[model samples]
Target: GGGGGGGGGGNTSHCAALTHIQDCLNLAFSTLDPISDRQNAPPAHTGYRVHIHMQRSFASNERTASSSSSSPSSYFVPTLSYWCFIPGMAFRRLSAYRLRSIILTSGTLSPLSTFARELYVPFPIRLENPHVIQNDQVWVGVVPVGPNGRRLCSKYDMRSDANYQDDLGNLVIHFSKTVPDGLLVFFPSYAVMAEIIDRWKTNAGSMASFAALRPSFSNSGDSNSHLSSLSTWDRISRNKFPVVEPRESSEFPAAIEEFRNRLGEGSKGNQERRDEGSNGPSSSSNGAVFFAVCRGKVSEGLDFSDRAGRAVIVTGIPFAMAKDSKVLLKKEVLDQEARTQQAQIVNCSNSNKGNNNSMSNSNNMSNSNNTNNNNNKNYHAGNHTHVTSPQPNSTSSSSSSSSS
Candidate 1:
């Protein structure tokens, strides 16, 4: 009897395909001996290393009621990645030796020597031109204290404090009221931004109470009555429409469009007020405040020129979390490399000292030999003069012989 059943042909083909894939993977991995070695290598030797990361996720498809009662469906995904710790290696590969030339230009490339050293390349010719804009064109100021006279510190420990959050919110409110057009506020991270926004909405005695005290207005004539009826968030939103940067890439376009539209509306309102000869608070312009994370989409490449970005307020420095596995690994690798470089420099200095000592000793020996040779020549000359002619006044004969 033939062994294959109805679906047996499909199973055979799938098995053959899997076997072929396995063979290919084996051949590829066999060539990567260094990567194989790195699997067991210590942190110090992890300059160029491969990391295996495990990701667990639930199945996207919903399980049947019968199956759900038994166990949830989930799977583990393993990802292997190779990382190069030395940034200089990349630059060296693309150096003048391999290519014609490498040119790097940036507005923020200050401390050029450090940058060049890190790249392991020498920039023989360098130019640093003066800024195109004059001093008065740009204005920079640091606000040390918040509206409540509390020190403005966005350190991780202080971020969760009630008083700190309230003061920070108050600072934002103050800026929102005063700064016309679009205000871009950047937080350290998405998580931090979310936490601050949550606090602003929920904290009864903080932002809500504060907003209640401030007078708000509507387009209608009864401004005081309208202010009393609005909620805390409504009061803040009325002053300026808030646009938050979404976490998903798919939603980014929509968020950006909303921000731009709000800006356009605010600009139109400002023009109308000016035409009517109305002298009112800047908040009356109905500008938009964009809340975005530092180093995110908004802060990275997007240009918010003119009225789109009147002021940019940075809440905190966007430093990487120290506890992250990748960060820790990178830090360890850099430290080890730094230590190795320092050791090489010290050894080189010691070797140089040894060479200098040897040279100095040889010079001293040569000088001594020259002195002895001169003495020997003098002795020989004296003996030759004595042998050639004998005289009763030896001193007079010696003087005459030397003079001759």
Candidate 2:
């Protein structure tokens, strides 16, 4: 009986092992099938395209159980492997055909027509309501040139230029001095923010000199010339406490909390100054300036209303990298799809016009035949009447009839 029980346990273990192996085999086969067959598959109406990515990582751990004492071996390991069909496949799965309805709402859904086309879903009703805030509550402006009289361009090639970086820094400093309360400065990306901040730190002296200048000198005739000589760093620190967004997700909460604390302190200081009857501008009144990346944690899914964010300064347009694999692939797909749709529309229109022309030609031919038959009947009747009746002189009647 004990031997029988042991045999049963062994059989159960074998079955479990077989099941695990089967699952792994199924997963591997499924992944490979998609890669092999995706090309042969029909074009997805849901705007879905497969994206395959393989990430490699170097593993050099000396503490590994298999490592020898003499040498710490390093080897490249494939850390991640994934393939996905993206953009709207998931949403398409939950489309009106399957679900009762789909409603999309967002503040940033500009160019609604393009968005609807991409989703490949018919949005019969669309509303672009007025902003919730009154018109007077918001102010928008475009600054084409920097304080140093240089055109502000944040293109990839121009980003590394020392003069451009300095100009951008100076612009930020200028905003820090002018804008009250919390100032939100958004750079295109974290790399740009880091580069600009590094440049400012290196040229701290010129920034200090600029910050020391009185408000009256800011609007002087030589302000632009003076700005060309100056750089940026300590000006922001003197005017507004600087808070930077962190790259790591875990560090963001702390950064946000610090920003709030700084803003609160500035507000408190302003109240105290007002109580003392000093209405002049003070450093505390300048509040905190948050240096954040566009589309980062600070920019999206967060609110900084009222005193927390009195002004926002976007350094440049946050355009996607042209060389990015995903972006390039998506763009190519969209362009191809657009061309295909245009060709289809043209073909359909031409076919409809051809049918209409054929019908019109047939109808015109029938109408012309009817008109010719009526004219012939009238001519025959006139001749028959002339021959049958003779009341006046034949020549005179014939002449009158011809004249008539």
Candidate 3:
């Protein structure tokens, strides 16, 4: 939503969860693109489901929230209490009329007249606004790369160019020369993550980068990796990232819980053991930066509050669209539903005449955006050279996920 265009599609996890939501609606999702279960299948419904990402340009203090039955199913609920963070400020402007109903649910919504002008909505709809709550607050942090650093390939697939300089080593060199003290190393696949750890995992050999692998507990318990051998997490607790915010699935949840217990209320568990007493380098030889391949479900949604995750190497475009095709279908179904709804609204508006301006219909943009992401964006297939050094004022470095 920045500088005008946001083609970044939803991730595997994001899309997957949205599918489950579709299932709840009892809406049969068929063909979808980027990675479709079927081809050329027409959309079935006018009302559809859509998903998008929240970038700095379109960060919202407002969102669309729905109420469900007290019973729970196989879906990821916000805070397990139906309370979730819905930042939809951008959408409200795009179709102020369509978004009016959604934004009215929030009293303290950042007033639309000003935003409407920025977005150029067709019609204006004002209603009683609900108070925007901020109780479930979390801290967000950012850190800069050290002098002379670079992006690497192993960050994409450790199994591919593992040694950092194996193939795309030049990318790492192109970016920065100095790896940080608390280095977080990310590998693409689990096998790749293991490959790198087996090679550079040790305290004696001057353990520079701390390798972050897929923690069993961090998973959604619905993955095939759930049944695999997982002895890597034990290593992380000893000298790894010192255990930050852990999800409900990790095996060491008890250990993490105990540490967070010591921290009193909310914590990154407890870094007391990993922390330097008031006057150390305030850093760690833990490499200089943390490294991890975006493997399993190690990093997503969860908060990395307080500390700075300085260098975040996405080790490849998270996961592939083909990894799960059902979401693509569900995504398509949502699109169809939305299109059908738009048609319905248009038909109704024509039928009801101008007397019902509230029956206005909006075009389908959310679907088209995601379809693009599911295809071209995830894995760039071009002459992508390796890079490093966060390009001065640049925070989002293009993660090199080019296929050989």
Q: How close is every model to the real structure, measured as TM-score?
A: 0.64, 0.60, 0.31
How do these models rank on lDDT, best leading? 1, 2, 3
TM-score of structure candidate 3: 0.31
lDDT of each: 0.67, 0.67, 0.36
Give the per-residue lDDT digits (tens) of candidate 3, residues 58-130.
1122211111121112222232111111122234334535443433333233665644442323335666544
- Tens-digit per-residue lDDT, 1-404, candidate 2: 99999999999999999998888556445443222122453344223344555543323333211112322234554433222333444454565357777889999999999887655567899999987899899998988876665678888889888778776777887788778788998989876787677777667445434434433325444454454454455556777888888766776887887787676534555665577667543434457889999999999998898878889989888988888766776777668767866987999999999999999999999999976675444333553434222345554234225433
Q: Model 1 — which ten-residue stretch has the worst lDDT? A: 62-71
Better of 2 and 3 by TM-score: 2
lDDT of 3 at 119: 33
Tell me how far the alpha carbon of residue 192 in candidate 1 is from the true structure, in angstroms, after superposition. 0.8
Which of candidates 1 and 3 is the stronger one according to lDDT?
A: 1
A best-first ranking of the candidates according to their TM-score comes to 1, 2, 3
CA shift at 302, candidate 3, in angstroms?
A: 6.1
Tell me the deviation in Å of residue 387 in model 2.
Answer: 22
- Give me the overall lDDT of model 3: 0.36
Q: Which candidate tops TM-score?
A: 1
Q: Which regions of candidate 1 fall more than 4 Å away from where they truly are?
A: 1-83, 95-97, 144-151, 202-208, 211-232, 265-285, 321-331, 364-404
